[model samples]
Target: MDSSAKPILVTGGTGYVGGRLIPRLLAGGHRVRALARSPERLHCRPWGGHARLEIAAGDALDRDAFVRAARGCGAAYYLIHSMNAHKGRFADADRRAADNMVAAARQNHLSRIIYLGGLGQQNHEALSHHLKSRHEVERILQAGPAPVTNLRAAMILGSGSASFEMLRYLVDRLPVMITPRWVRTPCQPIAIGNVLDYLQGCLGVDQTVGQTFDIGGPDILTYRDLIHMYAREAGLRQRLIIPVPVLTPWLSAKWVHLVTPVPASIAQPLAEGLSIPVVCRDHRIRNLVPVTIMDARQTIRNALARIRQEQVDTCWFDGGGSLPPEWTTCGDADYAGGTVLGGAHRIVLEGDARLVWSTVRTIGGKNGWYFAQSLWRLRGLLDRMVGGPGLRRGRRHPSDLRVGDGLDFWRVIALDPPKRLLLLAEMKTPGDALLEFMISPQGTDKVELKMISRFLPRGLAGILYWYALLPTHRWLFEGMLRAVARKTGLPVTHGPEKAAMTSALECRL
Candidate 1:
């Protein structure tokens, strides 16, 4: 793409929406510059490798970085919102960021600016702090020298978004939940993909400039209805959600902290805001852009499917290209072989891990390995000569796995619903090997799964065997995780899933 065709500069590109949006910019044949606090931390899945996308270090808060990055750009996308991370004064932060953007855009003589804001009727007094902050940011942007295209959005139902992730974690952890009247409130839910469509559409529409749009998913339903829709689509029974009129936002926030993965800092404002209904009142965006809308249930199904297929192009949390950790609550051992491994994420769903392990554990005589049956039989044959269980023991469960079950040349050592699974290798090796599986919740129902393959080298031969297999580890490990995520879940990519990821920060944002 030519530099002149590059229509705009994108802020919060390291954010959930930005993470996913940058690619569309490239696809639209526009040259783009993305703002990041740490350029080195910028990890773009689809566009990371694209030459059209440039990562420029900048924080919306840091006037210098903001101004410097915005200069010489044709336009700017003010997609950065401070609600999840900045507390109490997120509005103030929003204002400052907006001011900096305005100043920089004006100084750079940019032609236009596009921003994504929350939707609500401000005149009707229907606005939460989140919405209010969004509105405030819009006003600041519009008053600037550049024409502004503001798209106000409703509940986004995609993977990595803060709100989406919060709801997802809450539902998965608490099969039964206490009541909160806010959940009964009505709102509009938009698919993350659809939102991206509008956002990318903003790049070309001259009518969009100086106008505001209210964006939403295809379905308009109460919060509870949305929840029910998500639950049904996730292949689970209707989740138990009890709403109490008496639970104030403050109290409810603490309750949310206990149930969901969202930290109190974000949950407080978000929970309080839930009291206000969020829906698109105008059909402005519909008139301006041509696109298809997805119902609540279909949105849920597609979002989950995307994660399971490892097709989630990006994540809100890991958007900054940050290195995420894999957690295990003990029982990860270094076996006598030369491998290192861990378990699966706990709260996040391993849509396929549960099924894969279930099938692999029933190996022996005829069952064989669910995937690599030949290798399993060969290992078993070698194990038999080495006086190992081989394939003779079969398994305690033909299809189900337990703490003591035996599979071909491995025995189940640890088992936990969702979080973990451990297997001790009984194969003919110079030493022992332990396989630990762990999965972690990342940006809603998405999971970060880590498979640990640990082996302690017995001696020189043991070391050689393990070292010889070291190169194999990369392919096997990457392929295994990718396969599991294809079955497990990737970060939610489109719509609300593309919303910012909120961590359960003990400290305020």
Candidate 2:
């Protein structure tokens, strides 16, 4: 079979880099197979239904599933990473995942594996666990039977990236910032566009096969320099930065957690990585791929423009487990084991389902929750203090939603247009929680809108937490339903009545 004829397999199809790469490959006329844990999450991507693209449901850690997905592919892009896992366990997960990839590559007879790795000296004493794990994965892949192409990069600067977001939030929110010594460490940052170009370029260039290359932009600047550049690009005044040697990476991460949408779990590793200089040691790939490199200023400008225009293709938050909790779909209420506590409020609005649905879809983000604006802000602040996502992440699109898109601190788990939208809370809570909205058409012109909030408690604390907030929850739900009706420009015909959890479950059925 011709090498180009066989589909190219991409491992982290739903990730920040992988998500953007798939569309580019398809545009290049390559047959592409995207491997993801939840195939449903890929269904809403712009290129999700492309004629040349195929999505295979699998996890990189699952050897059997990985092998099955790689069976017929000629070459694979190893974009998978374990940074989203628990702090100390991510390194272990990355090791196991790389082992699985090596076995799968050998068993499936793949010709090449292209991996994107972090940039840092392998033997550097200051190297963080994240960089070490990346280096370890590169070694594991190179030891396999198939040839591997490793492209090492430092911080990626683009809209919707974790690094960019952290930079953006910090600079935008704080005019005067207390700092860490790592802020002065020199580093090279690459734009997402150039990274994608190099990735695609490697596929067709035989010279790139079985080779390792360091890739970065033209400028090598410190974090402080990047921050100043970002402020200039965003039309903001110069920031007052106080660099202190006493602030450890852990403390820096905690500070980032409170100031930005990035949680401590992700910020900590990133913070530790900055302590080491990550300038590119090899420039061989630059000539091999020969693409225009964007400087820090231009990169920040482009990212800001994308954000303002709401054209961010993928986000760092998009990379996580999006599968709905088991209790959400269980047939019986008792099947959830313990009592499932919930509150449901319904209102009959005098409008077509489409009109009501239009208002429902625009619930979060700048639109703001229909009622209790102050309360929402307070909750977001509290969530941030506890290392949660808070409401700062916001939604990808103003009025459109996909299964994996982040809406404030809630993730869209199930979305059905003109009918139902289910969101799972990513905020710190004692129990698992879900907020669901169902719109059912009435006799003729009217539609019944129902809002349900469910909580599967963890233990005694969870139960106490639910009861304490039950009154507030009821008020918020009722007010939100009424507000939605008012926004739809429709008269409320029936009561903003409280319903049972059973009714909410029945509506799903």
Please give the CA lDDT of all the candidate structures: 0.64, 0.89
Residue 381 in candidate 1 has what lDDT? 56
Off by over 4 Å in 2: 330-333, 503-509
Residue-level lDDT tens digits of model 2 in 1-509: 88779999999989999999999999999999989887878988867889999889988889899999998999999998877535568888898889998998899899999999999999999898899999999999999999999999999999999999999999999999999999999999999999999999999999999999999999999999998999999999999999998999888988988888888888888888899999999899988888988888889999999999989999998887456766667475554566778888899988799999999999899988989999998999998887778888778889878888889989988888899999899889998888999999989888999998888899999999999999787688889988998898899999799976663355352
Q: Candidate 1 on 1-509: residue-level lDDT in tens?
A: 33356546888876668878888888878878888764533442434667777778777888888778876688788888875533567778888989999988878888888898887777656457777878888888889899898887777777656577677767766778776888887788888889899988877777887887888876778878867777877767888888877888777766665554344556676775667777777887787888887777887787777766645544433432111112221333332123432222122233344453443333343555334445556766565554444664444334445343445456554556555666667556775566666544555334545556656556778878877877656555544444443432343232111111122111100
At residue 4, what lDDT does model 2 achieve?
Answer: 73
